[model samples]
Target chain A: MENLIDIKGVRHAYDTAAGKLPVLDGLEVSVKEGGFCAVVGPSGCGKSTLTRLIAGLMHPDEGEVWLHGEQVKGPRSTVGMAFQNPVLLEWRTILQNVMLPLEIVPGGLKGKAAVERAESLLALVGLEGFEDKRPSELSGGMRQRASLCRALVHQPDVLILDEPFGALDAFTREDLWQTMHEVKAKEPFTAVLITHDLRESIFLGDQVVVLSGRPARTQYVMEITRDGPPKLDDLYTPEASERLATLRHQIEIAQGRAEEGVSA
Target chain B: MTGTLRKILVPTAAMIIFLILWEALVWVMGWPNYKMASPSDLIPAYERYWELFLIMGWQTLWRTVLGLLLAIIVGTAIGMIMGFSRTMRDALYPLLVGFNAIPKATVVPIVALMFVGAHDFNTVLIAFMISFFPIAVSVSIGLSTLEPEYRDILRSLGASQTTIFWKIALPKTLPEFFGALKVSVTLAFIGTNLMEIVSPHGRGLGALFDSGKTNSDYPLMFAVLIALALLGIVLYYVVVALEKVFAGWAERQPG
Candidate 1:
């Protein structure tokens, strides 16, 4: 598979009242076309910064971020994003909210075509009856589903999930992970998921990348081999346990709790 | 009761109780009509000066409404400019605060003198000057405080600042805008009345109130006050209605 997203030696810093706060230092990552890459790291490890860099919302001070072999010079309309808060506009209905990107992204969809596309995506996320409902009327989980539909409405080249499920309860998060797989199977786009949950990373991602503490760099990368679509029961299996254990150890190392030489 | 019925019924009942209390208080005190006119006195006053009240009320209403409309346009423009740029906000905010701090009543004379012989224009000018501040402040706050996540979602789609403003900022700030309008509507009335009272051009409800004061016609003075209050209430409701139409999503169910 061809690399759809490539971040090489990305370094970024924020100028603060105190001084320059370095966030990303020599960070490197790549996700192949149609691949789900989950990035895990310590709190404030600049995982969110990495997503912005990939989405072209911001640029790195040094190194390159290439999407489909082209360097990102500025914000790209081809990127879709969802945050942990869902952040759906209170003024627009769920369907209208989903169609928001379509309106902004030029030559995407229009009129009846846009409505139909948004309705179909809403249906895919099991939000069929909520087409006319406001964002406040929906539950947290439901709002997140609508947010996901909005992100994908324009058929963007890359979809970025920045801790999108962090605020949801465990059960809701797991259900959304399944919904994510179903959506991706139909939509077929490369994705970068920034998450804190190790299980969530493994359950949804084909490959999980771990990052070290502040001024984060790619610490380790683990690829999961699964025979079929992910199932909740598979999480309890021996192979899954082994993968989880290895990833947990990597996270502990990333958080500087354990040494790299220590065996798991 | 349904929400709408209760909304209307509660205020109506309150007004009736208030009027009865005022009538009883005046009757018990045995105050003469010139010293204090009760609600009962207002009816005869209305009958005697119905034509004057109608004409003056119309003048005041139109001036206030016109000034409010101008304020909306100018305030929204200034708010958007400030909202879009930090440099502009920083530069303009202090000046706005200082201008707003000075009493609008004091400025009415200045405005009347500046545009002498233009009574209506002066009245409208004072109304605009008084009301625009709330609107500009509300709109700026609304724009500046927009959620970062929403901006990221739009910017990631390569949306221009103009597109963001039209699609997100305007709609998002509507609740605040309407809030400001409600406050501005009342302020506009004050501005109009101030001009009418200070530099009475022999027009508007304020002028009628002033003439009644001079003649010691207590009932007529109170009548004009009631008319002004009624106008303010009507205009405030108009703003509330517009808010429901534009920013109904912000209205949450009362717990």
Candidate 2:
């Protein structure tokens, strides 16, 4: 199977007033075709940077990023992303926000069919009747749901979620996680999610890539198994809980080193 | 009992009280009627030159409205260019700010002298000068704050620049554009009036007031001043009403 996303020893850093600060230092990770991969790390440890490299929002200072076997030269609209903040446009209604990408993309989506596509996407996220309501008029959870629809509306090959459920309450986040699982079951797509939630990473992602501290690179990759049906029943089992704990310890140790470097 | 009445009650009561005090102060101090006309005394003055005052007021209003409209159109265009292009903004913003800092009233007479026009072009020019900067600054700020998430989302979805501007930029900046206009309208009126005070062709309330002062016809001056007040109030209320109609959109806006 072709690797939908291929990142090989990518290095990136941003220019700041102080000086150049390193982010990703020779980090490599690849998402297998149709696999849900989550990169979990401390804040600013280049987990989100990996998403940008894959989505073509930013280029790696050194190294290659490939999407669907093609080298990413610049931004390709074929990747869909939702940020931690819902980022729903205030002026646009829920449905219109979801329909925006299709209008922008050269999909030739027009008239009633386009509208129906938007409606089905909105219905998929359980915001069926909220077609005419603006983002400001909706609750935080509802806004995020609308955001999911917007991400999927154009049917992009890759969907990237950067802490997508970070701002939501625990209950809402869990609910959306289940919804995402169902959505994936129906229409399988390659996704790279950057998250801090270990259980969430284990629950939704087929592969979990854990990073070292700042100036970080891929340190570990763990594969999760679902024999037949993807169910929430085994989320808190001993094996899953132990894995979650070990992931937490590794992240904490990596973070302590980063903090010490900052002080020094 | 009435919604409309409730809206105006505080301002109306305050105005009534002010008039009553003015009437008392004049009568008690033995101030001459010509020196300071009370609200009741100024009532006749409005009727005496009703036709002339109306015409002058209309001229100023036209100048103010057209000037502000022009400011929004030109300002938003320039602002969008500045907002989207970093090179343009860095090069132009400082120069624009320098222009904004210079008071229009000081330069109005010179501008009017340079332009040859039979109509109230001087007043219009003054209004435009005063309004232009505020509109430009507000629109530039509004457009610059175009949410990085917006570009990210659109880029990921394969959105082009033109579509982003029309569908995204225009609607987002709308509330702020109107807010800028609200500020611009007030300045436009002041600038036009200041020009009227100096221009050869200005027969507006400013000139009328100047004439009344020179001729020592305080009653006529007071009456014309009242008419000018009414004019300002009308223009201000018009913008306020527009904001009311667009309030739903404004409420959604982030500051």
Candidate 3:
């Protein structure tokens, strides 16, 4: 498969009042076309910054971030992004919010077709009969679902999710994982999910990349293979346990706190 | 249903109780009508001087409305410019804050000098100067509080700055704008009355107060004061109605 996203020797930093603070250093990642890539990292490890870079919301200070064959210059209309907060406009109804991207991107969807597309996406996310309701009227999970529809309605080339389900409870989070898997199965797109939950990464991701603490770099990349579908039972197996142990050990080492667990 | 009824009923009950207490105090004091008119005296005064009260009340109402309208337009524009540009905010915000600190009463004489005996225009000008700062400041604050991620969402979708302003920024400011308007309209009424008092001609309801003071007609003075209080209440309700119509969406709390 061709590489849909390529980040090579990228370094990024924020200039604060004190001085320039580095967030990413010598970062390299290659995601194949139509691949689901999950990046797992500790808090404040620049995981969200990686999504911002891939979405072209910001420029890397050094090296290149290529989407397809071309270098990313600025915000790309072809990329869809969702943050931890749904960021729905309170003034707009759910359907209108879903159609927001179409109104923004020049010469994109509009009129009757836009409405139909937004409605269909809402239905796909189990949000039928909620077209006219304002965002404040919906539950957090429902709002997130509506936002997911908004992100996907434009049919973007890539979808970047930055801790999209991190705010939800355990049960809602698990349910959304299934919903996301089903949606991807229905309509495939290259995806990058930035998360700290190890089980979530292993469950939803085709390839899980562990990232070190700030200034971040890739620590280990593991491909989650299974004979059949990934079940909750799979997490308890010896193979899955071993994989978890290895990744956890790598993360501890990356965070500079792996003294006692290095031999385990 | 009960909430709506309670909103109306509670204020009405309180006003009635207040009026009874005021009447009791006036009766017990046994002051002359010139010194302190009772509620009984006020009713007859209203009947006798209804024509004068109506004309002066209309004058005050129009001035207050016009002045507040101008303030809304000018203040919102200045605020938008300040909100959109960092340089403008940095340059103007401190100056506006300093300007707002000065007593608006002191400024009315200066404004009166500009119009130079144009009573109506002076009243409007004073009202506008008094009311516009809160609108401008609140609007600036509203625009500043917009989540950075909201801008990012629009930007990532390749939205132009104009599109962001119209669709997101303007709508986001509506609740704050209305909140400022509610405060500004009350200030606007006070400004008109203050200018009316200081103006040589003593225009509007303020003229009524000035004349009543000179003539020692306490009943007429009480009548005009009641009219002014009613005017304030009505104007405040106008803003409340507008808030309900425009900012109803903002009131929805997430379950």
Best by DockQ: 1
Considering every candidate listed, which one attains the maximal lDDT?
1
Q: Which lDDT value does model 3 have at B146?
A: 83
Distance from true position, residue B41, model 3, in Å?
2.0
TM-score of chain A of each: 0.98, 0.94, 0.95
List residue ranges in candidate 3 displaced over 4 A: A259-264, B1-14, B253-255
Candidate whose TM-score is highest? 1
Residue B44 CA displacement from its true place in model 3, Å: 2.7
Model 1, residue pairs in steric clash: none
Candidate 2 local lDDT, B166-241, one digit each (tens): 7777777777877887778878878878887777646677777777778887888878767777777787788878
**lDDT (tens digit, per residue) of candidate 1 on B1-255:** 998999999999999999999999999999988888999999999999999998999999999999999999999999988987899999999999999999998898788789888999999999999999999999999999999898899998989988888899999999999989999999999999999998855589999999999998999999999999999999999889988888888998666
- Residues A141-193 of candidate 2: C-alpha lDDT, one tens digit per residue: 88988888888877889999999999989989999999998888776788999
Better of 1 and 2 by TM-score: 1
For each candidate, the alpha-carbon lDDT, in order, equals 0.93, 0.81, 0.89
- Chain A TM-score, prediction 2: 0.94
In candidate 2, how many Å is residue A57 off? 2.4
Regions more than 4 Å wrong, model 1: B1-7, B253-255
